[model samples]
Target: MPDNGDLRDVESTPLQDTGVRVFAVPPAEGAGPGEIMQGFLEALTSDDPEYDTARKYLTSEAASAWRPERSTTVLANGPSITTDCVPGGREETNSATCVLTGTQVATVDAQQAYRPAGGPYRRKLHLTKNPENGQWRIDGLPDGVVMGKSDFQRNYRSVDKYYYASGTAVGATGQPAAVADPVFVRSKVDPMTQMVRSLLKGPTAWLGTVVRSSFPAGTALQKGVSGLAPDDQNKVTVPLNLKASRVAARTCSEMATQVLFTLRNLAPTLESVELRGAGGDRLCELNEEHAESAAWLGSARSPEYLYFLDGKRRLVRMPMRSTGTGAVAVPGPFGDGGRQLQSAAVSRDERTAAGVGNGGRSLYVSSLASGGSLGDPVLTSAGASPADRLTTPSWDARGDLWVADRDPHRPRLFVLEEGASEPEPVAVPHLSGRIEDARVAGDGVRIALVVAKGGKRSLFLGRIRRGGGDGQETAVDGLRSAAPDLEQVSAVSWAGGSRLLVVGQEQGGVQQMRYVQIDGSALDGPAPGALPGVKAIAASEDERAPLVAYSEDGVVRLPSGTQWQKIDKEGTAPVYPG
Candidate 1:
């Protein structure tokens, strides 16, 4: 079964139509050999956990030194290549990476959004050979969800006899045995208080990505600029570096509840900025009368909004809506919604302004002080279309905007609201793959959660229309995607109206920022273990706060607690516009 598709446009890559296949090749006839090692541990848990198909059946250096990012280093256990293979080792072949040590099996637990729902992962597999095609296959495993080796050697011999008999506690109370040794999961952080602390509220916005290399161009001190942030020890910028320069760029703006970062360098067209609470600034400097360009910018009230980008960035209906009296009418992105402005929302009594694209998909509401556009583009319709990748929208209280459509690889979620004709989508139930985040608090009730690309997930809170009606979601209770297990939970926010603020990873890969407190029950009792990427994350209904920003080389601040504070006296990456 070799057809995992898209392996460089088909040329033999078949891993059986995608869910990847082919494991145990030695078995000659009637099933047995533990059903060929349970179909070679279900083709090493589906696909691409990348051991490059277990180094083509492990041509061994003791199985790439038991590859788990190499470290712990081990080997020796060779003889048990057991797929039960009877008949004189049923046609053995040895070192095809010793089948990189095959082992896997977890039929279901739809990868609890990547760890936390029913928690349990230990999968470790391998088996390769295909030096371009001899065959064998299998490979890699544990991106989470393993359990099968006689139920993981009976839950690792009852957690190695409750942490070696008395040296510690499973639930704690007098104890004392011995024989421990096989311990794993390493991101720890649960001394007792956790269940995602009610999603602990307030302060959000942390988006930094600037790698450039060389130095000069417009050098705002980039290569390793941290300005401030020390404890949350994302190491205040671990070995942070950024010197090259393709004219850095990265944007984000909200104003008046703050979040106005726009570092742009387009070669000589300057615009540097740095503001979490507000610090580094220099808003503009483009030449030939500034044609810099406007990738994006939001906010239309508190402190003003609309700056799509000069010579008509469009959508300017703020406290500046004047037209008749003193005169001041600049509004152009029209809306009978024949579809023009693909994104923009302004209701909360700013009258109304919604969108979905031009040529009419529907979801438009206009009237910035009786203006011209906004007659349609408010909610568009027809067979579900308008979804330009939505990074983060969140409208709620019945206005319905809620847009965290992140989709990093099919990580689902979408909602438009108003009269409800199309935008629905929500499938996050046991989450399937990649989302990095989804926040929606305030009056949406709660939805904060961080998804994964490979386990380490926690900080849930569910409920907004969930219940038993198909999407099957009820209790949310979080705090297992690990905090006590150390740290990983990627990103989450809602910090007020019920609390919820997460954004994780501690110890080495760094970046730790907590603040959970949503009262339901952090996923009840168990289910913790999650971690992956995403370094910063924010969310704020203006102070309903939920921010966990971080950068490397320098700059850390974990807010919910009292330590970690450095506005980047070091950390780089924030040059802008990427």
Candidate 2:
């Protein structure tokens, strides 16, 4: 085995969890084929920036061909190596083949988008002994890099790059709604520079159709420019290529806002970002305050109140910031209990709401303000039972209402534009099961659904594709499991731009609550502590708000850094404004 060594320099920074810096150790002299392979594998997991040490174990030809950034394959454990001499080689008779085998867990593409993967992983590396130095060097190998899941977690961090929703505008805000596109990057590396480059590349293929980038086409960092870091005032200056040099002031400001939002999470101390053109002339400088005004981040807006169904099956709410405050019914028809509601959803603006009542057979829209009468059901289902009728309605950022009708004979998902138009059936191609519940994302481009099939319920996330002016019907495409491990999902709500709070039971396990990413990967942090008998759950886009749930103990809330506390014994379905 090669001896471990410290290769830290003046510029090296400590690893994420460990305070000490870790670097790759070059192969030792006279090392065996197995030892050489082991050293090369270890080097792939190190923070060598350019992977210079890892290349040392490879022959010059192989080194020139290897592209570590092409893709990353994460395994369940470190790959196992088995080496054997070739039966009869041509040019090099003294060559050995090393086979690496493991179970693949996930993969990160060149675009930095992460997707859960499974199945066996196999790769081959051919080695030959240098005649002059008698040193073993890999002559042929696969592209990119492979490492264990633990190393991937320690070396990489997930960050969201900001984009604007493609075809919607926030009312009166005069700004497009901001959407988050999550990607993984090396934490200790020059992450700020990496993130900026990724943002300039535009949204990933999966999200490209629904979101638009502020950067102009072919926009990129100026040639040979790298190593971006915040200055003493926590400000970062980005130099863009010629394509972005001639953008107008407003468009330039929008581009700067995207950089500010993307870097803020990676460097919380970031106060502003200045964009410079290829000519080294300042294009625009956007401070934190101005950035907020440039885009509408739905998740950053705190709700005014927490809404839920009370004992009388009426809509009620309590101040979001006040704990231990008694809930009161709003001054509306649904609040007066004249028309009992089974479930409800409030619009993003909080001026109106949509409720499902009459044993879930009817859907009604009403104003939350005082002195308003409840209108007749805008939509109805002919399902035989309440369970087979309308699910809870959800309002999107565009004020459109979404709900699913689980009637086994006529199952369908409907969207009411502006919550007033006739119900329009949403086409979900390749959907195999009945949608038990549906929740549209605040960006209006994604939807989460709890689908029931073969006596099992699962959570799925899908993209909402609107028709081009040519009269194409709106459809939900690319449906994939969001919580594949959960055998039964009772409820789900968007926790953030790319996360969902889920209540479900794993195969042969008791019911529990956890957070899952839209890409079907488990979140990094600990899941919410176990809560018994969780029937339904709710979470605000703003993470600071408490999580509300309806369980056997009635409606309860899990405040930040605290245990679950009862909100109302009679409240059965709890919800926050979409």
Candidate 3:
């Protein structure tokens, strides 16, 4: 047992926030082989300028060859080190090899994008002793570096590198369609540089076909400068290589948008961006207004209101951006019906609604405005009992409604396109379970599904491929685990273009919430604030929209705040327009 007094400190202290944290190096005086190895590992977490200090623990040849910026391997647990000395292997008659092993948590690419790498990590370091000073120094090792998760969090920050979505252009409604590619870069290093470099490199593997960058092929920073750094005036000057020098004036502004948006989260106080060529010639200057004007190129504006069902089973709305407002039922058939909804979703146009009945056996669709009359069930489940009926309904930007009929004997997932009379079945191969819930991404290209298998629930990301006769039919190409580490996934929602806010529990743990990339990598930052007794979860495509959920206390919304605030005394199936 632990002290109750000490537990308070742990409970009250929040997780590490986004900021620079400098890691210090201990004195190496009279350090043995083991001490030298530990010091070398710790030095990897130091800022770029302090990397010279890391070289101190390495031999001259090894120090010059090692490049910490090449890649970063993150471990789930602290590294275990074991050394073996060989008096006869080297001419110095004193050499040792230190083996480091741990379960790899993830790896940050040269572009700085973080991708899940769930497996074992093994590395070896060859060390030699300097007879004169009796100092043990690393003689040989791998090119990159590895560190534990805690240290990685302390040294790196997760930031979304923004890029225009496929086919998205200016004048688009809401936010520009942008897919967020979360990457990890050293907090103490030059994040602006990392972001710019990664943007030039383009989106990650899985998202490659879905998003495109503004930078031209072979575009890169100037040879001498590794990254862009802010000046005294909060102006960041980006020096591009010769490949980018031929860009036209209009294209330069678009290029500036990419850089500005990507660096916004990192340098929030940034005032302007200066584009330059290899020879120090100015290409363009984007002031604060220019950045602000183009910021929504690939993102969405915050939603106006959060919607859910009230105690009377009426659809209601809660103002998300303002305070001092009461929950008002939506005007129309949705609010007029005495119908009780177990789960529901609103279309992107905000004119239509799809809901699952209390027993989940009946699915209904109704117009959200007054003049429209309540209709009969739009779709029904084949389940014989309430527990085996339908899951929550979700709407995508294309006006397609998605839901899963949780019939264990005849489990199926369906999508109802606009103006369609009957829902169409989508094949989900390798689904060794029944579908619990499904949320389609705004682009209508991806779907997040929660499947229950062998008494355990799991979340999977599936790519939807539309092609069948008239191209109306859709099927999941394949299913990949997005929450492989969770014991059970109860709820999930698309938080952004390629990120999902998932509610699940780790092995042997209680329910918790966290943000994960579509590729399955966890987001970097404070664990998403949790809402106690939450039964369902919903989020808008706009990342800034408040997170809505149904809890024992009624309807709760987690705005850009640290705590969950109740909005309604009783509600369920809270959802935002897709």
Alpha-carbon TM-score of each model against the true structure? 0.24, 0.94, 0.80
Superposing every Cα of model 1 onto the true structure, what RMSD results? Answer: 24.8
Say which prediction, candidate 1 or candidate 3, comes out ahead on lDDT: 3
Instruction: Give Cα-based local distance difference scores for all models.
Output: 0.32, 0.89, 0.75
Worst 10 residues of 2 by lDDT: 82-91
* Clashes found in each candidate (C-alpha, N, C closer than 3 A): 121, 0, 4
Q: What's the ranking of the predictions by lDDT, best on top?
A: 2, 3, 1
Best by TM-score: 2
Per-residue lDDT over 418-529 for candidate 1, one digit per residue giving the tens place of the 0 to 100 score: 4234566665445544554455543343456555545555454454443355755423232223233324775554433333446666545564445543432122121122
Which tens-of-lDDT digit does each residue in 49-144 have in candidate 3?
A: 548878888888887888877788889986788554344455566778889999988887766767678778888888888888877888898877
lDDT of 2: 0.89
Any runs in candidate 2 off by more than 4 Å, and if so which?
1-20, 84-93, 243-245
Candidate 1 has an lDDT of 0.32
Give the lDDT of residue 284 in candidate 2.
89
Residue 505 in candidate 3 has what lDDT?
88
- For residue 47, give model 2's deviation from the true position in Å: 0.3
True lDDT of residue 395, candidate 2: 90
